[model samples]
Target: MNKILEASLKGEVLVIKTEGYLNKDLGQDIQDAAQEHIANGINHVLIDLEQSNIVNSIGASIIIELIEQLQETDGTLAFCNLAPIIEKTFKIMGLTKYCSCYSNENDAIEAMS
Candidate 1:
């Protein structure tokens, strides 16, 4: 099942770890979680998608929305541990132009922080 495994702050960045398919529902869940942190003045978001290997178009669009939302506050969005296909999809969707993809959580956190 699609679900957000965890949402927590790692330093000033909000880290959201997800599992299963990244469809509309899970994307919305991720947006909601990030929204809360954004409201509280957190600008950097790191999504750990090690367990989520699938993403639909709707999910990608929702992430586009999330990127816009973060931009409104001068925040940034990032991803880590993405599957090869997912990374390629994001690149094709132009997501890589806005956010970055890291090989692991530590690399992402270190870069974002």
Candidate 2:
């Protein structure tokens, strides 16, 4: 199934919740959403990936792009509730070095705060 990306603002952070597979199209959708929020001066971001278990290389690349964008503005991006396999994939791919991963939303929010 196609991925669904839902974004909302929480205080100064933009929270993005994703479901289904994260492929190129959905990755672009995520990127667009992040860019829009950044343009609006909301820099910190939290991505909840509990329901997104699969991510293609293109999607991963898009995430890297988002990280770069945030870093340029000294903003932060954190991921929470990642599936085990996806979390491992991110670690193996060294994404965790750039963006942090949390066990839950509360932890992520606290750290970002």
Candidate 3:
């Protein structure tokens, strides 16, 4: 299951908190919400993964897809509260080269702002 914790505006940035699994099944919804907010001119974003785990390759692909979309708009996406396994996975996949990760949501928010 995928849950959108909430969407908030912090100055010029947009923070999107996601809970639960991120898989191909939930990819579209995630993309939709992000695009909707980006359409409103909220570009910078922080995704909090504090409550989620178990992201498969498909999930990672979806996240990459979202990253591509955001990149096209010159927007940024940062991740927070990532598990060690997921963090390593992301690093191995070269995601860390493009996206930033923080120890906590507050740090992520600060990084984007």
RMSD vs true structure, all candidates: 0.6, 1.1, 1.4
Q: Each prediction's Cα lDDT score?
A: 0.95, 0.87, 0.79
Tens-digit lDDT track of model 3 for 1-113: 58778777878777777778776765555676788788888878777778777677787777788788788889888888998988988899988998999999777777788
TM-score of 2: 0.93
Candidate 1: Cα lDDT at 56: 91
Report the lDDT tens digits of candidate 2 across residue range 1-113: 65556798877878898888888988888888888889988889998988888888788888999999999899999999998888888888899999999999888888898
Q: Between prediction 1 and prediction 3, which has the larger TM-score?
A: 1
Put down candidate 1 lDDT per residue, 21-81, tens digits, no spaces.
9999999999999988898999999999999999998998999999998999888999999
Number of clashes found in candidate 3: 0
- Tell me which of candidates 2 and 3 scores higher on TM-score: 2
Which residues of candidate 2, in runs, are more than 4 Å off?
Answer: none
> Pick by TM-score: which candidate is best?
1
In candidate 2, residue 60 scores what lDDT?
82
